[model samples]
Target: MKAIVKLVILLFCVTAFSQGQQHVEYKKVSNNLIKATYYFADNSNAIQSEGFFNDKNQLQGMWVSYDTEGNKTIIAYYDKGKKVGVWTYFKDDKINFVTYKDNKLIGVEEKALVVN
Candidate 1:
């Protein structure tokens, strides 16, 4: 029963997220770089996420993601497509912070939401 409940909640979250899926937009920044942004189809046209890519089309710099209501949900840092530094994930009631290096998680901090 516990597993079934968890599955249901997971499915609900996935469905809700897919309903507001963002269409990615890519703009050439140079000979070998691109700036990417995502937009939802709800007519608001707000940026749902944005990031930068390097010459090899690998993610670099800071990548930020926003919820359907334009609330920031995540901020991740990458170096040449490898996850690095501390990544923060937000929700209404909880926050998860994880540190990574070379795409491997090195540390984590889970805390209650502090910012309203």
Candidate 2:
């Protein structure tokens, strides 16, 4: 009985600790812009990313992917953040684009358009 009680206590503590972690929040800056804040899941310092959202808060443009050091690796755009024009991929020679409507991709072309 004592062992079972101890195990229950341990499990409760673990669950509480886990729940205290995983922090994420988003704030609307305007009708079309939102700032998403992320935490380390351990309640550490938060990092922020800006996203463009439609009237329905659907993502339109976002900084997707990150470098090894956490720098933004891709700047993807959307009519709302739906991936409309060229998504500039940082690192190496890669370029991609996606066309979308209502947050659905209608067309995608990758590594095709290059700028000199």
Q: Write the per-residue lDDT of candidate 1 for residues 8-104, one digit (tens) a residue.
A: 9999999998777657788987886799998865644787899999999899989999987889999999999999999999978999999999999
| lDDT by residue (tens digit), candidate 2, 1-116 | 99999999999999999877756677788775776666555435544344556666666665565443566667776665455655666555666565555556677666754678
Tell me the lDDT of model 1 at 82: 98
| Native-referenced Cα lDDT, model 2 | 0.63
Assess candidate 1 and give its TM-score to the true structure: 0.71
> In model 2, what lDDT does residue 46 have?
42
Give every collision pair in model 1: none
> Candidates' TM-scores?
0.71, 0.52
- What local lDDT does model 2 show for residue 108? 63
Over all chains combined, what TM-score does candidate 2 have? 0.52
Candidate of highest lDDT: 1
For candidate 2, the 10 contiguous residues with the lowest summed lDDT are 42-51
Off by over 4 Å in 2: 1-21, 46-49, 91-116
